[model samples]
Target: MKLSQLGEFGLIKNARDIFKSLNENIVVGIGDDCAAIKLRKGFLLIATTDALVEGIHFKLDYIQPYQLGIKSININLSDIAAMGGIPLHALLSIAVPPNISVNFMDDFFKGVKDGAKRFKVSIIGGNVSSSKNEFSINMAILGEVKKKYMLLRKGAKAGDKIFVTGYLGDSAAGLEILKRSQKSEVRSQKKRKLIKRHLMPIPRLEEGRFLAVKKLATSMTDISDGLASDIRRICEESDVGANIFTKNIPISKELKDFTSSQLKTRGTHPADGSSKLITSLNFALYGGEDYELLFTAKPENVKKLKELWKNVNIPITMIGEITKKGINLVNIDGKAIPLTKEGYNHFKG
Candidate 1:
């Protein structure tokens, strides 16, 4: 059946299928009046709101209303999670066009519900309207974290080791493929890595909480705005400079394997011993929306984090150190580099 016939309910029902991908803490108000969450600790409540717009935040064709629905909420959840907070509640508001079907709205809410469920959070309330000609969503999320665990973008310090979770640059590559869809680029290995990373980014809520619990972070920021921007945030907040090494940055093996095979078969150089794939190391460093964590830790906790990486399989790479002074994204080979905030910033474009 076409989406026009499905109406809102049918769309919502369909989006429920991807709920398994988000947090598991949702209790009440999924299909009911306001999500009823039984916060285990009931600490001081913290909240945040973020918007995802049709043309600005995402394109409708690349991401369905359902996926956009889930993603819009998830990114906000990630913000709180970055602060080491447990998400509790959210209020969603949407603006839609007259031509849009009820099914699109339903699918959108279903995504909203499922995403909230992933964080064990809920939609306590929200508004819906049809006077606009575009799709827009805003979710205000509520959560709790210990006062001590409340991480601020300004808490990092000099002498702390700079670390980032997961790999980088996949999302940028993905965007490239998505835009170049008409050219039929046979899905390069590295390109797929970026695409997949961009499409289905997982918010590191649990891992972030774990970091806070262990008192492992001195300063932290996620790579949503790109490694350079987030690192710049931490450094500026701490009144320090950073020196990230090019050698240590982690690019995904999936990217390497895929790209290598594709290139080798086609007689092209997949990666010529240098690790960067789609964009250069500089691009990955500055390219935004990776959503992985970038944090600083005391020297002692840095050691502990290294050991922990093996157990959880969460790679914590030390790209550099918080220094006394300039955001120096340098090379071990003795080159002083000037860095740019190359990641996703609305004003930059």
Candidate 2:
């Protein structure tokens, strides 16, 4: 059945059935004027909202409705994670065209339910509306962190060490492969891995929480907008500068293979590995939506942080250092290049 047949009220009922709150703190969930939840005393609430629109943030050709649903929640959850908070509840609002299928909606909601379950978040309330042409999802997530454990982007100081969790550029490379595959046949294990990274980015919630509770991070931000852009944000907010060492930036072997394959397909010299490496580095620096944490800590905390992080198993690489005032990227040979805001820009034409 089409959404047009079920109508808005029926859709609401379906959503309510699928997303019944499991948390005791949620006094009221769906079917109410407003969702209500009890917050623990001495904790500060953190709220973040993110929207994904068809043809803008995503394309239905490559992304399934289920993946879209999960992506919507994860993106907002990432924001809360960046603030070092534990996501507790969410409000999901979606707009769909009349012709959208009931099964598609079901799959989408199933994804949402699965994501909420994995993250221990409750889908407490939401709204669904008709769209003229495109499908869109707007998710508002609410989380909490103890006042002393709250992390912000404005706390880095000069001489701090900058670190990023996990490898970068796989998502962007995945997206590139997806776009490329539409016109050409691209098949490989690396391609699949990269695509998975783009489709299902893992929010570093545990890492963020550990950093916050341990007071390990002086400043933190999630890499939704790529390292170059996000690092610039931290610098701007903290009134400091950064020097990122190109050699220290982490890129997975899978991503390197994908980039090499792409370059070879473009008729680049097979033996010119340097160009391929440079291309991969570009993706690592500017590719957005990795959803990894980019954080800084005082130089002195480096040893303790690494010691604590050993058990977590997430790869944390010290890619840079907080400088006194300007953003610069130092190459392998110590050539300092001026860095700019080159990440995703919603308004950039």
Candidate 3:
């Protein structure tokens, strides 16, 4: 059953039936000229949009339609999470070639439904168009947050402590493994966990909200573009600088093992451990799409923040501190090396 046979109306009807929503905030959902949503009083409305295109963001060989659906929604939700907002509704837009199978769309929507359901988000409406060759998906997510609890990229001040939630570079390392297509590596459970992280990044909504509601975070943003690049955003927005301690940056055990294996495969000995460590550290610093929360907190509140963070399951690490000037990475021996933005750039070429 190809999409060409179903035509546009049939495709939309299928979507309407599949994405039925009971969210009370939605005054009008799918099958309307415009989906109407009622904004809650005393809360600020937050909206964000993102796109995933074939060949650019992902390849069909490496990702399934279902996983693609989940990734698309999760990425957008991350923006909402960064602002300490609760997601309410979504508008999904997709363009596919006419030859695309109906089953493909069904599985994709199933993934979207499951992902949205996890955060209590409703799919209100979207537009479908026929593309010539490639597949593209774009999602606009709507959320709400109390004015007092809303967090932004600004407000980080000098001497504020920097923190990140969870491990970094797992997604980029997973992407590396997928591209290598090593049969043995793919079979390992540890490697599969990396692949899962790359495919379906978990948004740190609870962590973001906790930081916002407790007034713990002075500034915050999700690490979609890697620490090296995103930390610059905070510095630029807040007009401050940062000094990241290399030893404090959290690296997962699996990532260390993966880098070690790569060196061994290249005929390098474990005796030259510095080479392996640097490789893994580079990934933690420059690899994009980690989706973890990168935030700053005033030094005076660090004690209280740490005490309250015990209630959260995910671990938070203090990686660095806000400085007066210059973005630098401080080595173990206290050498400060200037850092650069090496994360994802749409027009780098």
lDDT of 3 by residue, 1-349 (tens): 9999999889898888889998787899999889999997899889999999998889988888889888989999999989998999999999999999999998899889889999999999999999999999999999999999999999899999999999998887787778768544435887888888899999999899999999999999999878998999999999999999999999998888887787634321112212233367777887778899999999999999999999999999999999998999999999999987666777861
Q: How far is candidate 2 from the true structure (C-alpha RMSD, Å)?
A: 3.6
Point out where model 3 deviates above 4 Å. Answer: 182-186, 264-278
Count clashing pairs, candidate 2: 0
- Per-residue error for 343 in candidate 3, Å, reads 1.1
Give the C-alpha miss distance for residue 166 in model 3, angstroms: 0.4
Query: How does each model score on TM-score?
Result: 0.81, 0.95, 0.95
Instruction: Provide backbone clash counts, one per model.
Output: 17, 0, 0
Clashing residue pairs, backbone N/CA/C < 3 A, model 3: none
Where is model 2 more than 4 Å wrong at Cα? Answer: 183-186, 264-278
- Candidate 1 lDDT by residue in tens digits, 305-345: 77766766567778888888888867878687867655556
Q: What is the C-alpha lDDT of each candidate?
A: 0.70, 0.88, 0.88
Stretch of 10 with least lDDT, candidate 1: 264-273
User: Candidate 1: where are CA atoms >4 Å away?
Assistant: 1-42, 183-193, 254-278
RMSD of each: 5.9, 3.6, 3.7
